[model samples]
Target: MFKAVLSDSNILKTSFDAISSIVDEVQMKADSDGLRLDALDRSHITFVHLEFKSALFDVYQCDEPLKINVDTEELMKVLKRAKSEDIVELTVDEGNFILTFENEARRTFKIRLIDIEYEAPSPPELEYPTEFEIPFSLLKDSIQDISIVSDKIALIVDADKLIASAEGEFGDAKIEYLHGEKITENAKSVFSLEKIKEMLKADKFSETAVLKLGNDMPLNLSLKMVSEEGELTFLLAPRIESEE
Candidate 1:
């Protein structure tokens, strides 16, 4: 048996919302340390890693480790009913995941677990030459602006600045940030604008996001959660242009 309580329900809700867009079902591993999840999208172009440490919860109790397979969309439906200030409690009993919210009134939901056949794959070890930190608001605004003209965006990072640019038949747009920490190496890559937008959904859960990039390689975006207890990370493969 396992039980955990959180004072703010939005933390859990926002997490699910960020992931459910790419994956429908996920396996949540609960242990003494905390809860962890790693899932790849159906196309395998994107991978998501999540962690919520025991200290992040108001109350955490687990005698043994447990892995629960849940449908993210269904879980979001239950979490959607929770008020922002409600205390959220989660428990596992007899193969069922129980969620309870307490505020002025009490609400309870029991969702059945599924037997997941897939196992979490080991993430590839990659080295990014360029790394920088940017506020979520700035990144979100840049993506939105570039997306207006093109379906893909080119990210260029050098010693002094980070740039996002897009061009299409309609027009072209570019946004640059020259305020972040300086980097030694330079890297440039193209990525799907839609995928970046989808991953930005986690911006609501974090203020600042760290980014890593390489030439013609995937983009790694990470958001550290409240109090630095947990993190949500996305690895998006770059969109390669064909030589015709």
Candidate 2:
């Protein structure tokens, strides 16, 4: 037996919105610890991870561990109907995953679970030269700034600042946010601006994001709840430039 009740519907609404854009389906495992999911996008350009502790839920119970596998897009469609003030209950029968939203009125949706052999992906063990935290809006703004000139943005970090820069045939854009981290090494990596923007759709998840980067390596970005009850993270593969 496994079930959970969330006091706020926005938690699932915003998260799946971002997640659906990257992955078509996911296998979420719920245990006594809480609920967690890890999935790699079909193209393997991105890996996403999400964890919600029991503390994040109004009611959480698990007599035995269980897996809920479903289509991400279909789940997001149902989640979109949720209101901010609504409470959401999650459960699964043998063939269906169920969601019930309660507010002024109660609404229930049953989504058929897909049968597939699934192995939860694990985040690769990565070591970065530099890591720092910045406002979530900074990433959103930088994506806009860089997209004006190029489809790719190079992220660079020195002791003084974090930079997002891009250049195209017609123009170039650069954004610098002074990150007062006592970083000893300088690192840089280039990534797709479109992919970054896709991950930023969960703007309500966290106010700040932690970044980890190394030259020509995947970029690691993490969003955490201030209460430390939940986290959403992504590892985006870098775009490689061919040498002439």
Candidate 3:
């Protein structure tokens, strides 16, 4: 038997909530090191990779090393029932999984074990020419502010600022942040505002989010948790404009 506890449950919860909006099933690997999931969209364009260490959970238990795949939507449903202050404990018995989140009183949630076929795809391996860290809260806020006005927002990053703008039939919205040394770029790429908004519906965003972006590939957004914990990185493919 193995068990571990974490200081914050929202870390995992928030990660799950963000991606469940697009994909239903997600592949998860849980071991002594921690839990990890690399989920990609059907188009293979966008991906969300999450690494959670054993210490992040209030109670992490394992009889043996295991890799399990589950319906992310359903899994999130079970986790949502947990309170912020509750201690979460997971265990497997009789080919079934049980999750108990409790303080004084405990509530047991169980789901049957089912095999879900999954393929692990390699992330883009090219070296990104640009990398920088911005306050996670600011990035989250910028996404939200732009989403209200348009479904798609263009991200234009240079040496001095990160700008988000949208110019659709409904009009336009733009947010520009001036910080750091200015790099070189008069170019821009667009992304789904709704998707970014869905991604930031988490508990804490007080930390910085590192962004690695360049070329015509995907934009990587990485967030770091506490030590002994893992990070979550989201790769979003750029949306190309029609030449019409």
Alpha carbon lDDT of each predicted model: 0.89, 0.92, 0.72
User: On TM-score, who's better, 2 or 3?
Assistant: 2
Per-residue C-alpha lDDT of model 2 across residues 1-244, encoded as one tens digit per residue: 8789998888788789999999999999999999999999989999999999988998999899988999999999999999998899999988999999998988999999986596988989998889989999988888998999999999999889999998899999999999999999999889998888889998889999999999899999999999999999999999997764
Q: How are the candidates ranked when ordered by lDDT, highest leading?
A: 2, 1, 3
RMSD each, Å: 1.2, 0.9, 2.5
**TM-score per model over all chains:** 0.96, 0.98, 0.87
Tell me the tens digit of each residue's lDDT in model 1 across 1-244.
Answer: 6999999887787778889888889999899999999999899988999999999999999899989899988898998898898999999888789999998888999988988898865566898888888998999999999988999999999788899998889799999899457688889999998888888877667898889999999999999975998889899999997765
Judged by TM-score, which candidate is best?
2
- Model 3 regions more than 4 Å off: 55-63, 181-187, 203-206
Per-residue lDDT tens digits for candidate 3, residues 24-99, read 7776777777778888877666688888877666567766777666777777899788788887777666665677
Best by lDDT: 2
lDDT of the structure predicted as candidate 3: 0.72
Could you tell me how far off, in angstroms, the CA of residue 222 lies in candidate 2 after the best superposition? Answer: 0.3
Off by over 4 Å in 2: none
Q: Which stretches of candidate 1 lie over 4 Å from their true place?
A: none
